[model samples]
Target: MYTKPPIRKIIHVDMDAFYASVEQLDNPNLKGKPIAVGGDGKRGVISAASYEARTFGVKSAMAGNLAVKLCPELVFVKPRFERYHEISKQIRAIFHDYTDLVEPLSLDEAYLDVTENKKGNPSASLIAKEIRARILNEIGLTASAGISINKFIAKIASDYNKPNGQKTVNPEEVISFLETLDIRKFYGVGKVTTEKMYQKGIFTGLDLKQKSLEYLDTHFGKSGRYFYYIVRGIHNSPVTPNRQRKSLAAERTFSENLSSEIFMLQKLDHIAEEVSNRLKKSKISGKTITLKIKYSDFTLHTRSKTLTYFINDKALILDTAKDLLYQESLNNSVRLLGISLSNLNTEAKKNTAGLSLNKKVSVQLKFDF
Candidate 1:
């Protein structure tokens, strides 16, 4: 009989209160004070809240008004995306130093598969310790790490020790540790699902793992399969690298609404020109031109037209947007109008490819991408 080894080592690293913590770290005067990163108005929502704000029930996505009501003295600050991204790059570099199997969940958290790490150390606990230490020493931040056999249990264990903490769960420890976990603490189980689990008498992991696949599927649909395996501390998802961007869009809110078609046409032309410049810069092209409009009463509409081939020319882009806008039945004063392009084409047509030298030069000018 062949017996399998009982322990597999995985690590989950999560930065502490990421955005607001960065803001506080850069500014000493803001230390120990409740902080939120977002707009400070009735229409705004808290993007991130520091631990201090969380102590008063302030949380991310809470309306700014409600967040303030909970913590009257909370300080609001705008998000610094560029700086945060730079810091994120720094931390990811540290991850790559150990293992290439790093799956970033967000700017603040990632899962690292260290079964065969670059450090050649058998103990994942020590690797996690060094990684956390390096992040603090190099980035002036605190992070928590959890080590287990797979992503499922590793993620759960990471949160077990937070705010400059780390924990490890061996294979034997997985079943026993998970048996007592709150149903709400399970990853991918959000509020509604949590309620449903409670209703099904699945208050803990033992209750979850005990259910048959057919029974769980009958109750929870497709996600039931995922829950079934997570309860058993089995996760098959691998660390995927960053995905290429398929499309990009830009929009704006006007200072005041304008009803004039001529004004909207002018705005669309400028937007098209900007998109053309970007297309040239990125060496990309799209066949689809989409026109979007928002009315003063908050109603919205969009129209799109896809050409036979991609184009990066400014005139072609503006003409397509203009045609789409003319087709729409506008009944109200438009507050904002925007244009976007998608469905990229990266090659010239077959006939155009074998064109004469002068024709080739002309086509290249008309289609810079």
Candidate 2:
């Protein structure tokens, strides 16, 4: 069998518990302690939980109730969208300094294809190190990185070394790595699917690779072809610059000074949903979603959240906006409600393109966030 040419140099960078980390970095008192970012409400979900909290079983998207139950001493703070957006901007600047091919998955993670990087450095490992150092020295935040040939491999590698760690998957090791990797660890695989796969005796990439393409097609449908290809370390996804913005939306001007927190939240949610629907229509997902709010006294604030994954769904974008708004204890009246989704999907970002063409694609959301 002929091995493919030397693999490309791809890097996936993810910031750990982004919102919680930024909060900790801003205030020294919060460092080294378990912290969670989100509202302490009945409906509030944990937006981000620090690594320390995670050790105690806390996780993002868990209910605020469950998170506190997991770690009784977990400190909860409201998200500061403006502050998070500032840090996100600083981090993206660092990425751009390295290469323009940076495709941000969200504010906390991005994929960088450095096969022919501008730094003229052939080794992607060095670049990842330099980038991490800069983020540490400047932003005072830690990031984990995965370096490999393609998005699938790099994503897996990045998670291998977590919490200020880095992992590099060399081309030669791809086969062995996939062979032993747990099927549950696959990028798009989730709990339900993993259990189902286990029932089928497909525990790892080796098992997946050994299956017939037709079998995978008849069973998992189109995703089967993708799994088969990725197991062999074949992925043609490209790094896309988040240049083309799909839509822009701003909130209407309010005549009255509103002091009700619920009212402001309701308004913001409405604006967010409208913008989100537009994104879905364009067949695009965005990393950045900006929320604009104007206080009664004309104090305007815009809070933007960049994500680790591309957000194409309306519910997620609106939820993020709602989370950001919940943090602002709106004692003052608001005048504006605006939200916009930017950094639409790049060429490689459009995973749905081929899936759209594939008649066998499943309608269910099989993967976990």
Candidate 3:
């Protein structure tokens, strides 16, 4: 039986340097300058950097000292979480005005399904443009949008012209557009996977499309199947709305590794504080506490303990994290420490209805996110 492919209209909207842009908007003096939002301590990591800062190699997750070295004139500002959250809610409200199906990835990015929008408009590209325009006019921030038949293509197209621009990939042009795209630009292809793909001569979507499924599966495991289908413009992951968070976590890496157990415990205390604060802010609790440790040599290990009851207390989290820490001896000096709470008690929501790709094409949709 041959079925036609199901077609959907998805739009991915990503803010341009969200935090930095907000900072720049709030303060006129910071405009047109290389700025980053994060702590400036020796061990601090960048949370976000403006486009001006990015040109000099400053990037999120980079060490503060390294970012300073990259751009000598870079300015650092403390993050204002409360303001960012308020703005995020405002942006989401704008999305709800158009469609009810909006999946937020973070405070800055989201995937919106506008196949049947509230305004009765048939053009997805026009809706995306209006959304971006609303964001700029109402909130005083710039956003880029991408419109396509599915989430995968929409996400990639969203990055084509960043910093207040929009791109649309019509269903008919998806295959050719993907052919020229670099394999590295594909979702789920990380640095390690990109290097592996380069070694296998899979540099672009076209090269990847030429590989056999069996060969891909053998080389890339289950992800190989994803790569094979995605390169052929076959991603079907829906824009899930009102998704419950499965976990909350916080972690930090130190500038210098520590071998002392006492030093590690001190770091765990800070990590516990972070995780507890996040849990409280979300008004959620969980039973499982996981402790992740990364050694100076880059080796990683994790220990977790599931409690009988949910907890979000800082002291309890710290105690549980400490117990997990001592469960395993320190194999090497630690470079990073993290704590996470899972097995949450949030309300579960599922979308049972499935969309038809085409009457002839049958896809076994598996929920992965």
Candidate 4:
């Protein structure tokens, strides 16, 4: 008799409208009102929108002016990143109580492998519920969770019940669940891919499953294989505990577009200083410096130079950014300037010991939850 493979238990925890929710929590007066976290000026971009504002078609990344037009009552507040970070740390501490295998996607979301948790819970669904409860009780914020065999499915399930809810896709239901899922709901299928899939008559997982591997590969290139596997609930990515940072950056959008190089130099100097300060705070340096320019017309450009040795000094970053700035003439009036450092020292560190780096892990045994 052959032994069955063990099914992994994964949970994805996502905070609901994290930034906006935090703003509402801290200031009771902002509760139940339309608010956006960002500047309200012409160049301001909405970083996060409260659910109340979302009802009025306000959303993250929307222009502040457009957001205001959409909802006249929309309140724009500057982002309090330090406060967000502090709250994020508290939430992560709650995660550590249940599992060491936590993979954070951002300050607001994370993937937790509860197959072997510190809490010794056999049911991933129960663990997710407990975790969400802890976050609400201790940190005073609502969160949503999805429990499944892999990250992709768990991530999708997390959205099924929005704003303080949880869903569990058991091992037996994975196949049927994937078959009925909307193609747009599939992880990694963005607006561009969704349109292409629709054109190819692949609006649902069942339609995608009917296409041969060669056919999908021909149409989607390398992503075709990814689509094929994930549609069948075959994503094997593990929840890495020590996900390293690959880059650090700082940028500023100007209220008024700058036309002269002299005006741009002053802006670049400030951006470089911000980048350098961030690098030092993280205790990391990089060999590559990149300059990003966004024109008033909304076209973006970037130029980079890699040095033999890493540097994190403000003056060095400014000097390098200045060289890249003058390398080419201004394409249009500059509306935003940013500096980023990559090829980070953090990337050179060794992987955490005892963690499997394999892209695929065998799953033969049907898990209980």
Among these predictions, the greatest lDDT belongs to 4
lDDT of 1 by residue, 59-120 (tens): 99776777888888989998898989989999999999999988888899998878788999
Q: What is the model-wide C-alpha lDDT for candidate 3?
A: 0.88
Q: Lowest-lDDT window of 10 residues in candidate 2?
A: 360-369
- Ranking of candidates on lDDT, top first: 4, 3, 1, 2
Tens-digit lDDT string for candidate 4 (1-369): 223224689999999999999999999999999999995745788899998999999999888888988999988888999999999999999999988999999999999988988988899999999999999998899999999999999999999999899999988888889899999999899999999999999989999989977899899998998887777777767898988899999888889989999999999889888899989998999999999999988899999999999999999999999999999998899888999999998895554223232344233436688
Q: Is candidate 3 or candidate 4 better by TM-score?
A: 4
lDDT score for residue 19 of model 4: 97
| Backbone clashes (count) for model 4 | 6
Q: How many steric clashes between backbone atoms does each model show?
A: 0, 7, 11, 6
Question: Which 10 residues in a row give candidate 4 its minimum summed lDDT?
Answer: 352-361
TM-score of candidate 1 to 2 decimals: 0.70
The model with the greater lDDT, 2 or 3, is 3
Query: Which residue pairs of candidate 2 clash?
Result: 106-307, 106-308, 107-306, 107-307, 146-158, 251-337, 258-333
How well does each candidate superpose onto the true structure, as a TM-score?
Answer: 0.70, 0.70, 0.86, 0.90
* Error in Å for residue 81 of model 4: 1.4
Q: What is the RMSD of candidate 4? A: 3.8
TM-score of 3: 0.86
